[model samples]
Target: MVRRPTERPGRNDEPDLPPNLFVIGLLHDLKEGGYSRHAWAAFWRASWIRSIQILEMSAELRASWLRFSVTGIVLIALSTVAVTAYFGIGQGIPFALTSVLWWGILMFDLAMHLGLMVNLESGELQQTLGWPNRLTELRGLAAVWVAWGAHWASAGVYVPLVLVFGLAAFTDLLDGWLARRRHASTRWGRLYDPFMDGLFFSVAAISLAVVGILPQWLAALVTLRYAFPIFGGITFLLIRRRTLRVRHTPWGRASSAGIALTVFAAALAAALGLPFQALAPFFYAAVGITALGAFVTILIRGIEQI
Candidate 1:
């Protein structure tokens, strides 16, 4: 089943953020000195210089632009790797990278779109985002790429795969804990945090399924479990041109946690030389909770909209 893309946010209720120092300074100068012919003529030159200086020194400006630049660079690097592998390296690149590339660009747009909101408010933006939180999203993206690696990973390499996947899963929890500890939760976090969860877990499930590490039936459920909300989110953004901002719910968190645990269990069962049937009990329970959670979340959002 095709699942909708997950994502969202709105800002009407939010108070306007203040302009950065450059703008504030210009405004202050004009208000204090009033407009004179020479000063007015010189103002543009001074403003341009001051703006450049401020942008160079401003942490927020650097951070926002830096994120966009870095993502663009990654895309280029992926493309280069793909081309090199196909041509120079005599190793064919996986076509899956195309999907990964587009997904990444979409995420890049989302990051910039959200980052711009708090850009002018350096203090607040810094408070709302940190290296740890950003790393979580990057980890999610890594999981997506890693999922493709599952195609090549099998019985012999399953151990390393499990350990790598475990790290990605750990980051999911780490980001939120870091945010809460710092009191840095923001609209971007609320919207994109779960979005990353869906992406990471879904891709991993699909890859594992392809490699026979997971049952096709279980993979389908897991995929749709993430797809529904994600596609719903993407649809919302396309039509409304804004984020959905669904309230974080208990069941939703449980669903994500359940998926992470269940996948780990599946990997572990393989690692331990246990039968797939042995994990049936755990998988069934996790699926039940996950499906139930998705239904409830969809229902709640429906009620909210009405």
Candidate 2:
């Protein structure tokens, strides 16, 4: 048989290509819309249009995010200073300074995670951080101050602790409701809310334990109840390269409520000069039961996600 010249793709005056080669070349041409130069021109033009549109839109999105973030930072700084100063004065200068330092560290940590404010559905930056998120931050700040002040609370100064703890508990209830009512929920709110809750209660548990309000074992259990889900979510993200959607299980909420109530009850008792130590067993049983329930339920739910 005589040998035939092999046709090159995108060439004229050549023999037709074999079926597979022809299909490949056709697909390549389709990538640019068609084989004609006009098609190629149109393809490049459309690509440029899309590129410009994306650049313009992204710049606006970034600007919007920056505005809200800056405003939020300012608000957080002002609130931290005011609250810490008010609560820390009763403790001491050192306590106030330490509280400020802790707040700074926490705000810095929050800034690191604040980039999650994008809408998961559209993958776009949210224009507004929303009042719900602002309220959540306020709640976290109050809880943090209370946790730190729990040490200085040895001076029979449980008033501020009770008030701050109450504020935290109230905001925890209100933030989600505000988010739903305003229809301003975002991926950031979903993730940040739980994280703040965990941070608040974990530190509160440890602080309460340090001050002899909660037993060591119960405190550890309370801390672990929030800690495990956060650890699991991070693990899932690292292993799967996707954000784990946090599911707010009833058990989880019940655990949080139990922990908060226990903290409040202890603080209130201390303020009233009552013997909370006598109720240690009751606190232990309640927190322990709820924590165990939340741990198992959340773990199973997280595993199901995986």
Candidate 3:
């Protein structure tokens, strides 16, 4: 006798299988004699449903992203107006243009990676953007402002630079605190926050060095503190096609705090006409200890992950 082809479920009088049945039956057969005709049908149907869901989610995500992008632009414009009004039109225009440029680049990059809220622990996607993420984005904009301020530090405007950066750093602490308190920690926030922190402090160090507020050696240490991890992350992503998750460590936090404190002190001292040479020892000790600790910790932890 010849073997007849197996009939696929839901093809004749059989009732359409429920989604769960599709998953369960497909999984069962997959582990047994491979995909039976019913399993193939279930798999195709399940795949179709998932494809529809993804497309719908993508559409909704675009709409939400547009709203978020518009808000960012409005805030950037307002910040430019306020800064220009206070600082005069000459520096104001250039500063505004630069801030807009930064915002555009950041927004474009985020749009390309378009994703909805992702739970920090479960890695599940959600529809809403929580306040923690909103605050993180706010901090990112503040970082752009700091970069502009850093560029102008050479003009002897130490006080303003200090104030701008101080507020930006404060937001860094605030975002994490609020995320924990609200139980709204997210993967995107975790990733974006650290990147912004690195950008914020790196600009502070390099700009100050160029302006002669910080010594070259200290600047290199600060830059390398962030540069190595960032480079490593990019390399890992390129090779593995996935992100390398580096857990926050005490040493990392200490390094960031040390850099911020050093920048604040140097800027304030310059503003007050205090001799920076007297403060050199303090800078070296703070940045040196923290940077070394952070560098070592990151290397060890990163290796463990690899």
By lDDT, the best candidate is: 3
Ranked by lDDT from best down, the candidates are 3, 2, 1
What lDDT tens digits, residue by residue, belong to model 1 across residues 1-306?
A: 112366223321222223235434554564455656665566577766654554555576466656755664565477447546644443224434554565567555544444433422234444234644575557656565556457436635565468767888888888777665555555455566677777788788878888887778777887787778778765654344344545556677787788788788777777777886766777768777767877777867744644
Q: What is the lDDT of residue 165 in candidate 3?
A: 78
Please identify which of the two predictions, 1 or 3, would achieve the higher TM-score against the true structure.
Answer: 3
Model 3 residue 248 CA deviation (Å) reads: 0.2
TM-score of each: 0.64, 0.68, 0.74
* Model 3 CA deviation exceeding 4 Å by range: 1-64, 240-242
Question: How much RMSD separates candidate 2 from the native structure?
Answer: 17.3
lDDT of 3 by residue, 80-124 (tens): 787778778887788778777877887766554444356654556
Name the 10 consecutive residues with the lowest summed lDDT in model 1.
10-19
Worst 10 residues of 2 by lDDT: 11-20
On a 0 to 100 scale, what is the lDDT of residue 130 in model 1?
A: 60
Q: What would the TM-score be for candidate 1 when compared with the true structure?
A: 0.64
User: Which of the numbered candidates is closest to the native, going by highest TM-score?
Assistant: 3
For TM-score, candidate 1 versus 2, the one ahead is 2
| Model 2 Cα lDDT, one tens digit per residue, 1-306 | 112377334311212111223223434554556347876676456545544454355555445445655664565566556656766545455554555565566555544444445544355556555677777776666665776558657766776678878888888888877765655566667777888898888777788788987677777887788888888876665454455546466787888888889988987887898898888678767888888898888778677767
Candidate 1 Cα errors over 4 Å, as ranges: 1-61, 64-107, 114-123, 127-129, 234-243
